[model samples]
Target: MSEADARLQDMELPTALYESTDDGYLATALTIGPWDAGLQHAGPPAALLLREAERAGAIEGGQTVRMAYDIFAPVPVGPVRITASVVRPGRRIELVETVLTAGDERPLMRLSAWRMRARSDGAAPEPPAPHPAASGPEESRRELAAFFTTEVAYHRALDWRFPTGSFNSPGPASAWTTPRCTLVAGEPMTPLQHLLVMTDAASGISAVLDWTTATFANVDLLVSLHRPPRGDWLGMDAVTTLGGTGAAQCTAVLFDAEGPIGRSAQSLFVEPR
Candidate 1:
């Protein structure tokens, strides 16, 4: 194994998905997704872009309220470049755009985030009701070997537990997940980054169609947060809807150990395998 790969294996949690290089960055195995060996999971690139956007637009006491990602091409596992810029700078609210591209500058994904100042307010809206406590990862661990036969690194890097549906079955499902690696090595992942990593699991957690005979590729991921999440465990109560047409949607309520913090939605293009 390469030195970089060796370093990644030593970490309990993947710190980052890519290692910096002279030109751009190298996509680690940790960035691999379920669909293909060459393609990466959407969460890693999204989180990476968010990290860059946050750096470009430094919000002192602000929190990300909304993040929208458009996946134009399959994010391949190799050298990639990322760029971020402030679209709308403000004292109370800021808008930032971040893009990811291949070595040849082929656009892979684009993310837009809205960050707003956080302050104490007596009239703040009440938080959503928390989902009932479920089994922890230890008690409810579910193996994903059957569904994801490929050697996807990110799949093995996370601990997943299903309370409603198994990976082989298809239906509305609820799951709790915790990452075993950091987004980038050395740089600790923030709560927001942690949440962003799990937000892309909407389609896998709740599938409206069969996995063997159908393919549901999420084209976009939209997440809105009401409050900052706390703790290692993230919950996803997801439901998927399929139309007669070739379009589908998956929506999920996001949660930390405490309660509901936000929601995430994904637009999927369904096709027969």
Candidate 2:
């Protein structure tokens, strides 16, 4: 393995994304992204916040039904703090909010999740539509390596396979992704945690414009799950649309090997690279 790849493989983040400090949680290189050399990717922070939310106010027999996040600033790749609280509590449902802040107390991102009790009367409605056949990762593993020239810590920690589209080209796409590393060291991730990590890839998987000359950074992410995702593989059938203005959106139908589990949407700020 390359030096960077070796670092990614043996990083301390396998047990937890950060080490607890009196002030807050410390950031790690594993959270780095390709957007800005000093900024962190949206996935790790989102998952970390969700982890806190789940710990603070998780209901028995409940699953995360919806999760929404708003990025207020570029999340720094250094020490950061997370605060979580229960907004609403109930027997069948609950709402929790988690906020991330940098060392300067500047807000980085805010996330809210809705947890609902699971119910199955043997009459659950049929899935809205059928998803495409499963596509193995080996098919596009080599292509993705060539497509992404920048070395991102998050991308190296996961295995991505595009079955319907090329990452070098732009358009609607379908891909299956699996996490190769844990969000928090030693702490096992729930199904919801696993899904949240992969949801942030919507924009990259379905790029509508040339990535070399333009940039599309998602400012917000919203994901809703009808049922908890199953298995290790998470499938995203994604499409990105850019308006005449600088705004754009990426939407994806989420799935596991079993079937469709939920949907995710991201609002992007398009600009020149």
Candidate 3:
């Protein structure tokens, strides 16, 4: 396999492909698409795509871009293409966009990198409370070799648990998540990585035994990482707020055995299975 092919076939995106030119690499995550379960469609794979772009120097740090994604029909489980381009570059921020396509359909996602700007003394946003340590389920040591994604690999390393839900349930579920390992790939997890793990677990929310026959997919996901997860064992206590009219949303409070780390919410499209 060529370097481009090697990058695409790298197991990071479940089953993705990569194309290259004089400019940069274009990757496509085939098996995992918009129609796949949220567990697959939303997570490290998407983040990895953006991170790959950053690593490729197509985008710099610090800038905000609205990432609007559309699910034109259901994304298939074959080959998909991810092509990225630099939109704007500035001293403090940069804008970039990447389009993921399978066959003839196109679903695009955008990213904005905003580097920290030097500022004088002024009022700053208050920091979030520390995440509480794993007391009940999060602390339990468990082996996870079944899950294929690297995100799940880290989950097992953290020794957390999902007290209730499974992947395709109806209501909210609790995930005893923690970082099993640190991000040796340069800086700690980018906000994109955090968002990937944060949004992927919604299916487990309905893990309660009674809510087993329902499923939902994210319509939109908004993530604001006040500070990246520095340690392992980030726990997620999640629940659904409004899931109707072919759409749903859920909220989760992330923790890491200190107090409260951060909060995340995702809008989902739902259906009965």
Winner by lDDT? 1
TM-score of 2: 0.87
Q: Between the candidate structures 1 and 2, which one is better when assessed by lDDT? A: 1
Order of quality (lDDT): 1, 2, 3
Per-model CA lDDT versus the true structure? 0.81, 0.77, 0.46
Model 2: per-residue lDDT, tens digit, 140-186?
Answer: 44334333444555666567787887556788888877776677665
**Residue 175 local lDDT, model 1:** 81
Report the candidate with higher TM-score, 2 versus 3: 2
TM-score sort, best first: 1, 2, 3
Where model 3 places Cα greater than 4 Å from the true spot, the runs are 1-40, 56-74, 108-128, 132-138, 141-160, 163-171, 178-195, 206-213, 255-261
Q: For model 1, how does the per-residue alpha-carbon lDDT over 132-230 read when each residue is reduced to its tens digit?
A: 436555566565535664544767656778877765678888888787677776677777887777788778878878777888999999999888888
Which residue pairs collide in model 2, if any? 14-185, 15-184, 15-185, 15-186, 16-184, 16-185
lDDT agreement of model 2 with the native: 0.77
Index of the highest-TM-score prediction: 1
Residue 53 error, candidate 1, Å: 1.1
Q: Please write out the lDDT profile of model 3 over residues 1-273, one tens digit for every residue.
A: 445435535544322222343443333332233233322344534554456445534323442323333333443433445676666655555555555555564564333433233344477856656444334453444333232343222232233366554344446666665443322232465444544544555444433322334456665544444444444445676777654476766777666554555566666666676
